[model samples]
Target: MASVSTIYTMGTFLSRAEGLGQRVRVLVEGNWITGTPLSCDGHGVILDSGAEGQFLVRVEAISAASYALPEATVPRPRPHEGSGDRVRDDADDRAYEGTYATVASLS
Candidate 1:
């Protein structure tokens, strides 16, 4: 759902949205293109869409836009966290297994 809709150019909308929040929601790809506008000009704009990564879009292409202005609340945990799997850290394992000891002996 779009919070606000505007008929301004992408650059104009971005400049205005900066006061509210640089992060904007625009219907670029039907999949995922909502993110913070990294840079914009009269031609194209670069959007740093999280996960989806940054991409360029023509200013003229963007019409009405919206913002996912997150209310002041606790951030939600990412899906990768606590997925019943221990995150592997080779350095920690190496330290536990005393790889340093082997290296020290060689030195």
Candidate 2:
């Protein structure tokens, strides 16, 4: 048998955009939270509601502190290449960092 871990995070809806290579829906604990394109940069996303905050999430069977919703849910910024891009990776890192930082700071 294989052992699995889960990850969790809490962050605000930064921003949502369309026309990206992928469209992913951000969810919290299996609950629909919001949707945003995967083209986000390191600056973090700007929510359409113009609100800034954080959210709490959990990842099942994963050790990662954070997890990306799914490619099918969130469209990729670039589809032609069929490979991950720097921008998307950076955005993910930023998102995780933001959440982790916020939690750490609070503690």
> Which has the greatest TM-score?
1
Estimate, for each residue in 1-107, the C-alpha lDDT of model 1 and write its tens digit.
76986675667887666555568766543433466877777687677755556767776665556775542433334447668855655554454441111011100
Score residue 43 of candidate 1 by CA lDDT.
Answer: 84
lDDT of 2 by residue, 1-107 (tens): 99997642322222223343322344333344333433333244322211334332332311222223442333335634746544456656445442311221111
Provide the RMSD of all predictions against the true structure, rounded to 1 decimal: 15.2, 17.2
TM-score versus the correct structure, for each prediction:
0.47, 0.20
Count of clashing residue pairs in every prediction:
0, 24
lDDT of 2: 0.33
Segments of candidate 2 deviating more than 4 angstroms: 1-20, 28-31, 47-107
Error of 1 at 102 (Å): 49
Tell me how far the alpha carbon of residue 62 in candidate 2 is from the true structure, in angstroms, after superposition.
Answer: 14
